[model samples]
Target: MASRAPGEPDYQRLAFRYEPMAGRGERRPVIVVGAGPVGLAAAIDLARQGVPVLLIDDDDKLSQGSRAICFAKRTLEIFDRLGCGQRMVEKGVTWNRGKVFVRDEEVYAFDLLPEGGHRRPAFVNLQQYYVEGFLLDCALALPAIDIRWRHRLTGISQDENGVTIEVETPEGTQSLACDWLIAADGARSATRKALGLVSSGRTFRDRFLIADVRMEADFPAERWFWFDPPFHPNRSVLLHQQPDQVWRVDFQLGWEADPIEEQKPEKVMPRLRALLGEAAEFELEWVSVYTFSCLRLDRFRHGRVLFAGDSAHGVSPFGARGANSGIQDAENLAWKLGLVVKGLAPETLLDSYDAERVEAADENILASTRSTDFITPKSEASRDFRDAALDLARDCPFARRLVNSGRLSVPSTYRTSPLTTADRDAFAGPLEPGAPVPDAPIRIGGREGWFLDEVGGAFTLIVFAGQGALPDTDALRPDPLPLDRIVVTPPGQDGDPPLHARAVEDREGLLARRFDAAPGTVYLLRPDQHVCARWRSFDAAAVAAALQRAAGGEIGRC
Candidate 1:
């Protein structure tokens, strides 16, 4: 493989081996379409779970521009599980503070990671190309994943048991079959179109021009959003620093503005010059005009075919919801698909993917819609309200709460998910069922590590055994899917080692505080690391029932 140039990606064409498929009619267990971040993430995750994945993409190159630059902490953790988080964090620019401006006056500023002691930062700004490259490398390194570039999904059809897809390769067209299909084919999804699926939602009239420029500057690594700035009169603008001396600038253009003309060098140069001033020398790397919509499919799961990422739902970029949510969708779906493929869980478990992710999509759409509405008010009354909020936010702290300059991406809690085993006992903290496991510093045999790192990517039963012996494995489920058990003891417990091999000491009492842990509290965590159930005391029958419920089985609650 050839190395990529400074700003250009090397488009390496991968070999297609459909001839062998023709000789032996074999249906792969999983087929992931599209090679973008979401598709790559799903493929990598499935491969990690010991599932063989066939990843197909229409293109052989990375994304052209710095698209979807903001990556949330949760997404980074998912990347960490996928084996590429360290590289992304090292190569991306980390920013937690964001300053909102009304004209030239700074009104309000906020910090995403207000508290300390986190493994990952609040967010990172890396170009979409870099993300895809890292994900592609991770996928290639995994033996279970076979990536076929230039393999376009031209047709798709599914029945009760499997899906048959037609691919258009450089050589010719070929047909392939799969027991499961994951459509991560992006916003203009060819697979979605072939399946005759259409997304329904509101498309905003507002437009935005994104310009990626390369320049040596001393701008702080922070998000700067201007509402009616003097540089660009009435429209809103956003600026952020990226890696490699590159910067992203977004200019809000009204509905009537011509996108083609706005993208021209003549039109873009003046705006860039006004923003950066005449003395600043900068080279334009990429420019594009875009209009976003908050749209989603009626259902993410259709029989044997499933949709993930932009193929299932899309939100405006203001909140960084686009790629971040897509990556999460991949993570959420991967574990369920893995369990189903292994026959450890019922097929009905897959239905929870749609039920939970649709709720998440609605949330992202709502947040993005509100941000768009605030940034570009459609009515005079709305503009008056927005201006009032901004004006008062300059002085009063209460008014700052009203300002919504894109509610930066955060993982959605699947509170109402069917997979969640409802909490029957009273709990004090936020480590509830369906919520992602909170990260905390823990001491394991004199070494420090994150709590999430120890309990993720498997069905884990975390026993807060404060000076108590760990629960015996014989008491738990006899033999289901592999369940990892970790015993977290209180600080300075000199008790004998527990039954489980993995044990940690909550030296700072962070886990105790975050989880409201008692001497015998137990938490049942899903493979994706979301809390499925918790109890004040360990009950083998309850834990077994919850595990069955988490895996889409009918059972009585304790």
Candidate 2:
């Protein structure tokens, strides 16, 4: 264990405990490698679904420094489902507005969450160590998870049925087997290396210095980005406020900058003074120089071994997509893997994980590549284009869309996913099939609550209704996979709660508006809270068919 440091998280080393099963040649259902935010999230989500998991990590303590600080809304919502969202939110700085500046002059700004009625904020800035600690605590509370620290996976081989792995622990090297293996060991993944897999993509030729400074300043909790600032002419700079009076400052150090020299306090302090003025008081808590690449494997799944998080894909940190997308990967995979492990769905269902997440990775890669290009243009023409966009953004609203100070992270919509059932009726909003279910305020049994909290972690049929009679959902329930139903009626409507399904009131009319629901709108949500199918009205047969499709049963539908 490490001693606590002032203005820093105490990095406590976890004692290595040898697993006796390694001596017995016993096999576990799921084994997750690397206990970072992604691996821990995967383990906790799997455990919540009654899937036993053996989580192993090479490091004994939490990662040093605030590696990933800007957590997006969708990631926080997933954390909320994992039982630690509130803790992260309370301990982190929350913000939605982001301002763009060009040469020390203020340009247009944007609000990530322009509208209200969402349960969580658009983004929360928290240190990665705090996130890992919270997720670690959640995993520790679950009996189904056995987390082993200081367990390094040195070798791996997978066949049609399972995967065999060799792990080097503090005691000795041992062989272990698992029915399924999730490789989340990060960008320099040992698991990916053992498999002889390749992650091909372009690596940007630029570096940035991240300085986490502890200061008692009254900066607003918003994202501030400057392009070609006066202090650092022809370079970019970003500012973000974090909890505990720590402000994250990123200075664009081009390819010519020496990373070793740039990280020293003498070099870093001058840059800070240039931005914060000479009289500003602050202490550097952590500092590092990093270059990023947008890359991902050709596929996320190989036989019974699945790759997740950075092991599966990676994006530049500009948009905070690395950890956010990794966490999304964990959420997207856990439910499908859970069903497959439980024999509720065929092993083929896991293929959808590959299809959907690959698309997501591609989307993130595209966005990240664009942001990197705009931020650090390789050619003079590209830099001119970016500058023009930023300059015109002040007067023209259309030009504002061209500026890319990191699109920020948003949940992916698996529109082409094999499991999605195309809408048979016209929809008026963004709640399309394969879209994540939007969260909204609601009232349940006269108590205020969130719409998503009432219906997730299972296959649910949500029917938006009015004061009219509720639809009968008795015939909608399927065997072996009972479909839970919820009736969300408009507020101030006189009605008795339905006996067959849980009922909630759309207190602010946000639910109905967000989902584009009318008196009889119906939506079938998967266990992961993504819409598989929807209709203008409740159709039991349609709901059942969509349910089957979502559960890996084709039912002769696309």
Candidate 3:
């Protein structure tokens, strides 16, 4: 077990420099409130896209405890685009399999990453403080991002053109303005409250006690869930491994249990001892009792003000959806906001962020709610059903699928989004419109790299011209927004030179098999790496129309 250090964060306090905003009459392009993972990620994404960003946080340091510990593959991929994926993966605990138990007997287990070829694993378990610190370092390295510490948003006013905000600093009050404002201030968002927006959802009556402890246990890096175990009869408990030998233990307490009493050392120590035996030696790291609710706002966007992360929506920790979904929200909005700010897309493009993410929130909320219900059955009938499922899961292979400890987070597909270009040709595999671009190993410049690494943070046009002549793209250029082209050719196509600077040889044929690509097939991808459109053959006019639709120019066509 790792020893605890005093004042763990030890981050330096940044000086607040206030300029006369009224006299200069200057308005920044974008202002992001909160310095958490979501806000810092948005700032980095925007800055990487050549947009100046102002990131303000009320706290001078990173998050105190390991608030969010699960980082999904999609979220990690987004972090990769923001320039900190490798650092995070190296520091975090990676795991792919999870086991579920009924009493002392194991019922079912599942592997999240069943397939290979992806650069990232299914998920990484790292403390929130580490993620925030890494994102802050990445943001500071970007010259276009200005991070202000100890600057809190006090008041906000928005008009047709932009937003005006009053910030409270350590020195005094300062006024700042921006064309757009992102509220990542967390669940009890001051920005959301000031905007008079309300979140609507159900709060579960059951409470869970979370305990982080440093113990030199020999448990493998996997999620272990127990229902009605001897140590905690008729209740549920979960355990996960994290970095620095810190283990997170969650015990489900009934509605009648007092939250304050459950967090006390006297009450918590007994439970820990029961789970880890009397002879186990361990140091307590952190403890908290929380009642999770599945809630979200009616709208994520209002005029010039936008919301992301927990401020936009919140879910139970059972599914590990909260932070992962928030990071996805930042990734989804950053590119659209960049295009809008750069005048490459219409203001209506921002509306898709609300549409796509609201749907994603609902999906997450639904999954989390189901998992919560299964874990903590509210009624006798529910309890019977859950027990029956677990009992059947032990013997029947089909019933194993019915067991749900928590449906670990997966990226949502925006199939019905307005920006998705409906497929005109039949495809076999999962590379459909609104789906994230699947990763595959490929050879670029005689170097090995994943497909996603080549087509991120920018609009990409991938043409699968198998050992044939390439199409002329000179006549079909989308203005303002830069479009990068990658030609994927057959294995023995080095004799015929590539039309573009970037060309990848489909060495293993994984790209062709996964995408169901044929000769002359073309795929148009968005900056967020979602497939927007595809065609059996490249048509200049059709591609142009699809690009226009993708940029939120024409309605009803997508």
Candidate 4:
């Protein structure tokens, strides 16, 4: 279902009401709160792992916000793993570059997470409503999914065994119990607030007014940031393209201007005209004025109750990292939860979820806050220096590289995570197995083609072409050493590497391209396409170990 924008809060009924549970209801394994991208993603991931999921939303209706519009490639890869990649790529706009300007002149432009030696999943521009709807559809298709709408959570209590939640429903107040709980609520997350988690960081003094407008501007569909606006000398304007033939424009409103008062079309339309020329004809789709802060939870997990998405960290929306990072938190948590619940991995694995993801979350917050400082500096001298750099970087590639690298949202790696398990028997050196493995060209045995990613091979297997070398397995695993279980292909394969999917290697004998491992190295990739284990040389022992590991598991290996 398509949702209306943030302004049309015709969303019926107050946010909370009282309800009561009178009878004994069945308990679920996992109960997820919030139906937004982060919550929904966690629910869907759990459901896919064969864990029953109960998804709760404050209001029954789909959200209406231009809330999260841009998804980085790593995110797209996760969607692909969930069977929605092609649809997203096909339905959304693909962008490669973005530009920065000062006084109407181009100053800095750069790549968004430069291609990691392969055709990466492109950064897509689609409304948050559409993304959620798509994910909701996927969740419904799963046999174990239960999405509860109009369910407002008022309180929570947890014991070692499970958790109980107090929710106000349309009917009355009630309590729901589950083995695990994930609060994906928002920055003002009731869950985080309830836990009394200490969040650090000050809210920005300057508020940003964002509007989805229809205008005949000649600007390219890529992201455009301004160092200093020509109209508002003290503030800046940000322009980004969106679907539905509309664009999103943001202006700093000096913290004191009221959003409700600014809703007057007469006042808002003229400001939009300030960005696009006066001749540009446009209509407003939605307008919002919100403030952001660089706050983070003192802890992501407190006992059995866990926090995901904005419930965990809140980043300034400069690089479009907030929502994407939250969704990733869901991905990492859901899989580990599945393992622990199924008795596949130890509870120790769960501890790593908070430790690893919090690092990633902190990085996201730091990156976003830095981006915010670059575009909307708080100090007067900093603002002046920022403008001068923009003015001079117009023709300087060196300066452009410096500015552009920061804007591109690169895939966050887990090199420092405690959960990023590296084993010498299965892995060599300091390779982070849980990291998104770089793309490699390889040969498959079945078809008469040389291209990789055949059958959507992003997180699939890689086969060595000739001599059929045995690849030792068990190198890359995040934690608890599943042995054979992982979404990434292990280095060993039963049959000869399919010629169609073999990585083309250089003769001097190193991989010249991204996947260029030495000859006879069969690599297995994870769902996020990270290299798990690779075979320096494959043999019967390596192949047998992989098969043995695959057979002994609650999680199926395909």
Candidate 5:
């Protein structure tokens, strides 16, 4: 076993023994299995909030492959919170177009840019390996996190005080205790299986041949697909560009494969040539065959064990929603877990994690299922319908619009969520309270324009047009919690809004309408862009009480 340097990010050669904490380091708050995106995300979040986390994974090195490439704007917003969005944007390609071909002929093309006044929806195609490395680097740098590789979770048992995890390491077997455990060990999750969680979803009849290649081709930098795929001799093919000139190529295995014929790259290349014609000169970086399946665990949390990422939900990689959804899983669960570990909210608050995340994971499954269904449809009739739709889309811009947008990933509005407002007319329509606040760019003090997300962190109190005095956030504010920067839009007026809540110069609803505010309405937005609470206008007492309740406390004390 090896150990990482004090500040060196990569810890591949390092391992830490689980010494039973008896004195200073006896009880840990959480133990997370799997060092993938979701696991690392959870660890970082807990560490940020001063919780101790021990992360375990079997893999020693980051998995290399352009597995999941596309990241939605919501995912970017999440990275923004963690201070990584700028680097991601700088390192990835923000795609806005896609092309579809039928029988080697261009059939349809679509623009993905947001229409109307919607915020620009851009997706990045970065190799999953790089992303993990970046996140791992960030996570391990924190003093409260310890990531252990070559550790496979074999058994887990929990009691009243905490949970115990049995791991098989190179040296020997060991047990670690913690307040809770997160199972992010992928679809064939050992942890989920141990808890007897049921996951059910259909496997597609056809298989897909995936080839990650470094290609310098004439094709534009976009998601390129060939319909009526000759490679499959039935379905179609897709190509996604990655950061380093690598492309993820997928072709449906239309015909029953002869094990002998399927093994040869020559066979696959010939078929690819038939489709690409002159453009087939592109080089193949790596290739493998993967089966497409859609599955979701019956539960996202079980006792002290919670599942995120593929362990909670599995989707075909066609739409690349899998990892993005998992990252979101971390964002939601992390905050709640932070509060629970801190004793702000009851452990029962963990139940809502399953409820809300299960809904979002279902959304991801449906979207990826649809994308898979469209690309490698089950029935011949369905395949024909898909082709015809693409052809028609080429002729009609309206038809192309939907295909192009890929339905742009929108945040799930937890309308029925226990964490949401049940008041019927409390919040505005078109957007939900617990959903990602639509990007409304309002100029700050008449100088520059920034979107709603740029309004800074912490709870945002959105005061509608011409409202009243600032709520007595101090009254309800929890002890050690800061609410001093509360921004009030005012009782009525058209002026610039302050950058931070506490910096207003006595006038402006600048950021309120940026979030689509209405007069006589007050909006409270959470750090993850969800609505926490709201009112008609700012009332010192009532608002303070609600804020107190929202803070899970009285006048002061978290």
Candidate 6:
């Protein structure tokens, strides 16, 4: 059965109940404040790792409009780990290539995922409500998660041990305590406000109108962006296809445009008719005007209260960076917080979440800021530069690289992360320490699968073997921490049985070529599927030491 209709969602207000134990001062393990995609994803990730979580949200309904309609490949892969990727990809509109135009003329085209062997597409256009609904279903099914709707966080304070929060429930105000508090409440975070922390960054003066229209159209399943089109004279426009005969259209209205007036049907219809032609027939499903800013807190962790998603940072919607990066924040924070809460790693391990994610947030901010400036030129000189670049891009290949129709979102690389053990072996291609591992095709036990499927949820050692016995992992795994292994053999190797680690035959040599692998080449991956360390040959001692360092233990080298 479908969750909601194609045009707009029927808002469902979930019931609210008072849990006596929450206010009775019994300390809980983890409490996540917010039920958006980021909060739900965080709660689910922690729960899957055997950590009980209490997820609270101030409101009872899913997000209203088609806000955040784009989900990137990295975000989908993270969803796969959360056990909801298949449903999302099956329901959302998938696309990989997009075209750019200048004054109704095509300037250049780009392909985000030009190569194959990946599980999910480069981008999926689904409404934020659908994303939230799917994630909520996942959270409810996990026995470790307790979701409380209409539980607003009114006050928060933290000490060296844990955080104490005051929540406003249906019955009355209540007090709760937890070992850690995750604030995913969104851009205007009550938790951040209560703590007196501020996010510092720049805010653009331009505005954009989002019109979700329901119509039968022939637009291809691809991103089509225009700079100074004929219909909308000097301004930019963006078009995207969503599931269920709905389309998302974005028109750039200048800073002086009145937000209320622009959202009216009379004002919006003229613009739509101009683009779709006067003869077209359609119904306006949803309409809104928005102004965005790029900002983030100086530190994601304040005492025992941690922040993720919009509560921690926010960016312009141009690049689809806000939600994608926020979900990633949950991924980065979950494993570290899980280890810290379980006492398997020291509390200091949580600090790396700040160090690594802050680096990523800063990178995203820089990219988003640049895209905004290019799309909306602040000065005549800037517009001239952009126009010239667009004109030259039609012919010169080098100028095409300069044309920025909002450089689409991609996963951030944590090259400066403190948890990464610097590369000691010479390597080629882009799979380096602190980089997210790329996926390839493989066959294991007479079944085909992707490379990433065999390498998540724990610290993993991927050993590239060549038609030989599977490498023994007896000495590689350390005490109290389970390390998984995937032994990749040559393409034609037959499946073997009774091995300590799972073995896969590189079905097309894609895995070998992607990882720059050779006989006995070893890669050490963190729980979040990031490469922490690698070597030309499998050295049990080096891999063990690197694994320990990645878990926030003392840094060791071999």
Compared with the true structure, the alpha-carbon lDDT of candidate 4 equals 0.65
Model 5, 331-361: lDDT tens digits are 7888778877888667766777888899887
Which portions of model 5 miss their true places by more than 4 Å?
1-25, 104-108, 115-121, 229-233, 258-263, 275-281, 380-384, 387-408, 423-429, 440-458, 464-475, 478-485, 488-501, 504-511, 518-521, 540-558
Q: What tens-digit string does per-residue lDDT give for candidate 3 at 193-246?
A: 888889989888898999999999999999999988999999999999988889
lDDT of each: 0.87, 0.88, 0.87, 0.65, 0.67, 0.87
Clash count, one per candidate? 0, 0, 0, 36, 10, 0
Candidate 4 lDDT tens digits, 489-535:
22332243333233333222122234444445555544344554456
Q: After superposing candidate 2 on the true structure, give the runs of residues whose Cα lies further than 4 Å from its correct spot.
A: 1-24, 394-397, 555-558
Question: Taking the tens digit of each residue's C-alpha lDDT, what string does model 1 give over 1-558?
Answer: 112346554423323243223322679999999989999999999999999999888876767677889999999999988999998999899999999988899888999998766789999999898899889889889999987878889998888889999998878888989999999999999999999999999888899999998888888999999988988998899999888788999999889999999999999989999999999888898899999888999999999999999999989899899999999999999999999999988888888899899999999999999998898787889999998998898889898888888999999888988888888999986577899987888888778788877877889988887654566755775376888988887887633555554788887788888898888998999888899999999899999988888887852221
Models 1 onward score TM values of 0.95, 0.95, 0.95, 0.81, 0.83, 0.96
Q: Candidate 1 regions off by >4 Å?
A: 1-24, 494-496, 555-558
Candidate 4 matches the true fold with a TM-score of: 0.81
lDDT of 1: 0.87
Q: Could you give candidate 2's per-residue lDDT for residues 1-558 as a string of tens digits?
A: 111336544433334455544333878999999999999999999999999999999867777788899998889889988999998998889999999988877776889999889989999999888899888889989999998887899999878878999988877888889999999899999999999999999889999999999888877999999988989888899999987788999999999999999999999999999999899988999999999888899999999888999998888888889999999999999999999899888888888999999999999999999999899887889988988898898788898889888989999998988899998999986678899999999988888989878876889888888646667877666888856788888887534656768888899999998998889888899888899999988888988878888988872333
RMSD of each: 2.9, 2.6, 2.5, 6.5, 5.7, 2.4
Please give, for residues 1-558, the per-residue lDDT of candidate 6 as tens digits.
223456543433334354534446688899999999999999999999999999998977888877988999999999999999998999899999899988888878999999999988999999888899889889989999988888889998888888889989778888889999999999999999989899988888899999999888999999999988999988999999987788999999999999999999999999999999999889888899999888999999887888998998888888889999999999999999998888888777888888888888888898888888789887889889988998898789898888888878888887877788898888999788999999888898889888877877888888888755555767665878878877888888865533567888899999889889998799989999999899988778988878888898862221
lDDT of 6 at 408: 80
* Candidate with the larger lDDT of 3 and 6: 3
What local lDDT score does residue 195 receive in model 6, on the 0 to 100 scale?
A: 91
